[model samples]
Target: MSTVFDFAANLLGGGEKPLADFSGQVLLIVNTASKCGFTPQYEGLEALYRQYGARGFSVLGFPCNQFGAQEPGDSAAIAQFCSLTYDVTFPMFAKVDVNGADAHPLFKFLKGEAKGILGTEPIKWNFTKFLVDRKGEVAGRFAPTTTPKDLEKEIEKLL
Candidate 1:
């Protein structure tokens, strides 16, 4: 009976943030990478956050270096890159592994709630997104190729 609200994550700003703090909000949880080809997706994600954030919508970014060592930066560098390059304003968590034994507990719960293509649980690459509804239930899983802009309608429905 574990919900997303049951977990907590370390923020890039250097503290633990319980998911329960975002209760009743539609969340787009994304595993991001600063050097990935899809890095630009941050801009679209920021747009989505700005467009719907006031309506109980949020984009929670988690940087992961498991793929091609694309996100090797520390919290400061990640924060700076996201700020200066993409101007991302949404909440971002400390770097974590999206796939593997050491995967963050929240991610484990998210992947368990929403499997990917062919019922796969592992995140295929960086930028893979998991959408959670207001009730902290996983709504859908989007692949790395799926752009943040592509999830607007679905997010609207949840909101």
Candidate 2:
């Protein structure tokens, strides 16, 4: 059975990071855009990470430019923006294509695991979120309109 751990992504820093590093932890994975209206989600996401990090929960952010060209900056700039603006301390990954032919393998697997509204698999917009349980199985998919605060109960259940 293929899991998200089967794929590896580039860290915002300079190394390849395999999703396997997060094994056994509940994960809230999101495709982010710095310049989009939803960019403020970084604050809520960071709050979730800080609140639950010690309890085997993690929030992973992946910058994606596929929507509205909102994330046109390079990895370093993206990293800096998140840190300076939102004080985001969670793991941020390199820019990736969340849709289309170049979509990262991990995202493809994630979408397959949990389809979005009306069973549509394609991500509708940036800030699309996926919740993964400790066993590395996808638990649920949240739409761009779903705020991070709305996920608290579900996250608590997973923890």
Candidate 3:
């Protein structure tokens, strides 16, 4: 079976990073947007990363413009905004579509691993998060409304 490590993504700062590089670590993968209402979640996510990062935990952020055009910035703008605004230190990727025909392969795998409300596969909005265990297996999926702070317990369990 294809594990989460079977995928790769482009980093916001440039270059590609294979998910296999993060194998054996607990991962919190999120589709983010700089202008969305959930943008502030970056702070919480950063906190989570800081809190559990030493314990084999990581947060991989993927910017997306699919929802309300909330993330219209280019990679440079996205990188600058994240650094200056939330001081986010987690790894962030270039913008990608999380729904429809143009969706990223990693996201397609994520949605398949953990369906949303009522078993729906399409992501409703940005900041949708998927939790992956140390084995690179999808553990759970959280909606846009699920705050990163609320995920600490689950993350601890995986650690």
Candidate 4:
């Protein structure tokens, strides 16, 4: 079957990266926006990454502007804001659209793999999360309001 490894994108630091590089690790893929109200969630997300990274878990952050233009900056600006504001150390990808016709192929596949509230596949806002298991299969989808702290148990289960 096709897996996340089949897709590739530009990393925040300017390098081509394939999702396959993350194979065999449980990943918490999140669409982030530095100016959004949920921006504080970065602290919690980073905490999770630090706590579980050694145990085969990672938080992949992707800056997205489809939500109210909350992420209007370029890659460098997004990287600066995330590092300065939240001290995020996890991998960050370039800005991408998470919904509509121009959505990233990886995100489109993710949404198709795990529909959200009431079977909706469209991402409602920034900070929406998708939990992926080691096998690259989607484990669950979390809403923007679902704080990262609340997902510890689920992550623990996967780890």
Off by over 4 Å in 3: none
Error of 3 at 140 (Å): 0.3
Measured on C-alpha atoms, candidate 1 has an lDDT of 0.94
TM-score of every model versus the real structure: 0.98, 0.98, 0.99, 0.97
Off by over 4 Å in 1: none
Q: Of the candidates numbered 2 and 4, which has the greater TM-score value?
A: 2
Candidate 4 local lDDT, residue 27: 93
lDDT of each: 0.94, 0.93, 0.96, 0.92
For candidate 1, the per-residue lDDT at 113 reads 93
Candidate 1 minimal-lDDT segment of 10 residues: 143-152
Clashing pairs in 1: none
Report the number of clashing residue pairs per model.
Answer: 0, 0, 0, 0
Tens-digit lDDT track of model 4 for 73-94: 9888999888998899999999
Top candidate on lDDT is: 3
Q: Model 3 TM-score?
A: 0.99
- Residue-level lDDT of model 2, residues 1-159, one tens digit each, is 987767789998879998899999999999999999999888999999999999999999999999999999998899889989999999999999988889999999999999988998899999999999999989999998889989999999999
Candidate 3 per-residue lDDT over residues 7-41, each given as its tens digit: 99999999999999999999999999999999999
Rank order by lDDT, top first? 3, 1, 2, 4
